[model samples]
Target: MSRLPAVFATGLILALAGGAAAVQRLPATPEPARLTGWPQPAEMPGFGDDGTLGPAEISDLTEYVLALAGAQRDEAAVIRAVPLYQTHCAACHGLGGEGAEILGTPDLTRRQFRVVTGPADIRLQIWHGDDGRGPMREAQRRSGRPHG
Candidate 1:
């Protein structure tokens, strides 16, 4: 007989016993702390009273974003987009869309895109991020880059 099996069994038993003991030590009813001098929730500046955009406002903003995507070649839009892209996307996608293979970022300069079909598709991807790939979606979400 090997000592390895006995050692493994003993370790597992000890781990289970430890977990059970810890669980048993937990309080059945947790006490809620009395509210002290914490600041009450207040309306934030620049967010209206509710901190949200209405449906119509959201729709209009989405339409405006779509228009901007469609007008990427327009001089003013290009100027605005260039800085935005550099700030938000260049870290992963590269400054010139060359992509970073080590980070699994895809090249964007290619004529044929694997994911995007049109301006709307690009906008959706920008807003939602890629699910099949890395943390692009989560990164966009954390950055809170205004999609609309």
Candidate 2:
């Protein structure tokens, strides 16, 4: 047998032993801290508007809205809210909630856009329109939709 084989085998054994020892000496990673509450933005002023809907209604409608946005699923809720969306949202938001860029409406299908972060932010937008001020507010008020 050539001495080359023996040298290669010794080097491989030493490398394996060194790697194992290094791994054994490594510190254990600690578990990440658990979060206790909703994100701070949801609780900020002028952002957490739950609107005129009752808690149950809000929850159900939120499920429906998120579903329309392609973020969630609740067939019953979607069915129930279809007419409401058609009446109130489809005008500017588009029938599929794709939004109208020329009209400055943000696409609802996306999970986040501008001030809208989640359901709470969506609720605020639904209640207050885009900026909680100006023409959209007047339009919502004139249309008899909740504008707070």
Error of 2 at 120 (Å): 1.5
- TM-score top scorer: 2
Tens digit of per-residue lDDT, candidate 2, span 46-133? 2114444444444555676699667657788778777767765677668887876655565767643564445665554555444434
Q: What's the CA error at residue 92 for candidate 1, in Å?
A: 0.4
Output the TM-score of candidate 1. 0.41
- Candidate 1's residue-wise lDDT over 2-100, tens digit each? 799999999999999999999999899977653344333211122112334433333333343343434344355555456555655666667776665
Clashing pairs in 1: none
Off by over 4 Å in 2: 1-60, 132-148
- Looking at candidate 2, the ten consecutive residues that score lowest on lDDT are 39-48
The count of residue-pair clashes in candidate 1 stands at 0
lDDT for model 2, please: 0.58
The CA lDDT at 134 in model 2 is 28
lDDT of each: 0.50, 0.58
